[model samples]
Target: MSVKIAVLGAGSWGTVLADLLANNGHEVRLWGNSAETAAEINDHHTNKHYLPDFKVSPKVVATLDLKSTLAGVQAILFVIPTAAMRIVAKQVAPILAETGAKPIIISATKGLEQNTHKRISQIIGDEFPAELAEGLVIFSGPSHAEDVATHDITSLTVASQNIGDAEWVQAIFMNDYFRLYTNDDMVGVELGGALKNVIAIGAGILHGLGYGDNTKAALITRGLAEISRLGIEMGANPLTFMGLSGIGDLIVTSTSVHSRNWRCGNALGQGQKLDDVLANMGQVVEGVGTAKAAHELAQQHHVEMPISESIYRVLYENANVQDEINKLMQRRGRREMDFQR
Candidate 1:
């Protein structure tokens, strides 16, 4: 059961996903903004700038023209950054309407919108009509592009408002090396995916400051609590935070050397300027922007998220990293509170 899938955005994640689909015997069109990257992927079957030294599947083709890429697609996967989701969705909606094609739209991007603080699926739903947007699915977990590209065993969750749609996504993405489980809690899944990045930044800061596993473990544990609190306030299931997209994603992103957010925060904790860290990374550090959105959302929802707020200040307010760390440690301790409250 091979499907023609169009994967929008050809960053490292997008390229690796497209390659994975191609390996699964599906025809994949990877849409990239850069004509040079498209040419490189098409002609040489390599995305050197992103997935350097890795040979992409020949079945995976790359193109700069969105219209051409969407011409005969059966399913659409949006893997672009959160900031670009709306603009790209707006562009795709008219074309999709004109083509009279209704594909199961899947979003793999994880982040809340800056000003609106909407989830990626909600942003897509706002741009596209109900027919195509209502069945949106979110694919996320602890899986990293670098690991998946190397055929490492990776597991993720495919969450949707509709169980059938989630199952459908699970079927396509599941394989020997890559496996997916279906979940109906889209809100929880998306929030868990988006919120964990802030904690990962904190973890990286700990690493940059030469802290050991004890400190990292404390941050990861407390970070999960903060994410779950805010997520519950925003109408998410508390149990979802205990699953793949929550603690699982948190562990990977916060500790993995491949995580852009961790790397960016590590550089920052080492006294590098934000501008310098971002400029040198050559990749989007989603947590930097997500931290701001999380801080705003926490304030609006009246949820106390000290860790996320501290990361936000360090990233945006020129707050000293060590000072914020000290403040977090010196905060008054309370009796062990129930997370399910």
Candidate 2:
């Protein structure tokens, strides 16, 4: 059964997913924001911006027109960065509502909206009415676009308030090259996706500072404890953090060199300015925004996420990173702490 699918965004993940689906015999259209990128994908079948070496499948067509991107599509997979989601959603909502397509809308971006503190799904729902917001899904987990392009063993979770709709997403995504799972914990899955980037940055800072495995281990472990604590307070299932999107993503991102947040932190640890690192990468480091948001969330909920708080101060308040580290390490506190809290 061939499904008509359109992926909005020609970045690494979008290109990789377009390839996976096209190779699996689906009609896949890739939409790019830039005319040059759209041309590269349509004419050359390559994404010079993200994945330059790999050639995309012929079944994958690229378009610059938003209306063309949504034409005859059964599902819309949004792969744009979190910062650009609102602009993209505004463009799609009218098309989706007027055309009566009501296609399954899935957001692949990870990170909360800084100003509104809303999740991607929440942003979409707020932009579109309930009738337009139906069939919403979030695709996230430990999967990285670079590794997935190389046919690595990448598994991820598809979550939605609607289980039946999420199952549709699982069916469309699962193939021999990639495995998929269905989850109902939308909050846990989403927070894990958005929050791990901040922890990964901290991990990179530790690595750049000549820290050993023991130190990295502690950061990863304790970092997860903090995320779990806040996530539980925010109505997320505590056990979800122990699953694929939680500890699994944190371990992979903090340990690997592929994470953009980790790379940004590595530069920061090497004493590079935030602007310099971001200018060089030419990509959004979601942790930069999420760090502050999570830090604010912690303050609002009276949850102590020291790691996040420290990063927030270092990034926003211009606090000394070394001093922040010391504050966490030598905190005057009691023992026998519950990992849950």
Candidate 3:
């Protein structure tokens, strides 16, 4: 069955996803804040600023009008940055109420609110009514926009509180090149997606500092351990961290050049200032903000996350990257399998 979907965002990931849905025979309304991007997508079938070489499907309509974009749509997918998530959700709420539209909410954005430490789904739920928010779906995994643009095989997890909602999303997004699995552990799935960005920064730091495979392997291993520890303390399923959203996400984001977080961390590790690194990236490096939120969450829960803590200091406190790395190496060793703080 064909569905009318509103995709909110025009970044590389958003454009690619909109095109994918259009290719799958869905009517896609892509909304972005920039009129220039919207015009480019509609007139040229391209989003040169984000995905320079890729052509957007002409079937997808790009617009800056949120009200029109949501009009009669059955699903809305948010691919915006975490900082903008709440504001956008607030705007969408009144519009939905006016239209009486009960669309399925899907969040592809990954990051906890820096102030409240709430997940993306929680933020959306806080803005929208219970009826519209109850079945919200979270899309996450190791997939990257660059790879997906070229039709590289990509698998993702679509998790929801309601299993039926997740399966419905899986059906819409599944294709020969794009595969989605349904999981009901929304808490674990969101945390794994958000927290892995922080670990990826650490991985990029190691690479920027000229560390080899052995050191990178150790950091990734230890990073997953801390991520799992904090996640378990926050009411997430332990086994979920072992799946696609957890270890799989960490490995890809940390190692791939396509990751904005990894690239930002690489710039910082090379002694560039945070402001300069961010300005140059032209995209949001989610890890920079997620590191702070993860740090606060760890403190509140009394969880030991030394790697994330060190990353937080390095990014926010003007601490030297090498000095932080030294501190991590000098910390007291514990059992490899220990989850207790």
Write down the TM-score of every candidate. 0.98, 0.97, 0.99
Give lDDT tens digits, candidate 2, residues 115-212: 77888888988888786465689898888888888889988888888889899888877887688788889889989989999999999998888888
Show where candidate 3 strays beyond 4 Å. none
Give the worst 10-residue stretch by lDDT in candidate 1: 332-341
User: Candidate 1: where are CA atoms >4 Å away?
Assistant: none
Point out the worst 10-residue segment of candidate 2 by lDDT. 332-341
lDDT of 3 by residue, 186-220 (tens): 89999999999999998888888899999888888
Give me the displacement of residue 2 in model 1, in angstroms.
Answer: 0.6
lDDT of 3: 0.93
lDDT of 1 at 221: 93
Q: Which structure is stronger by lDDT: 1 or 2?
A: 1
Which candidate leads in lDDT?
A: 3
In order, the Cα lDDT scores of the candidates are 0.91, 0.87, 0.93
lDDT of 1: 0.91
Error of 1 at 32 (Å): 0.7
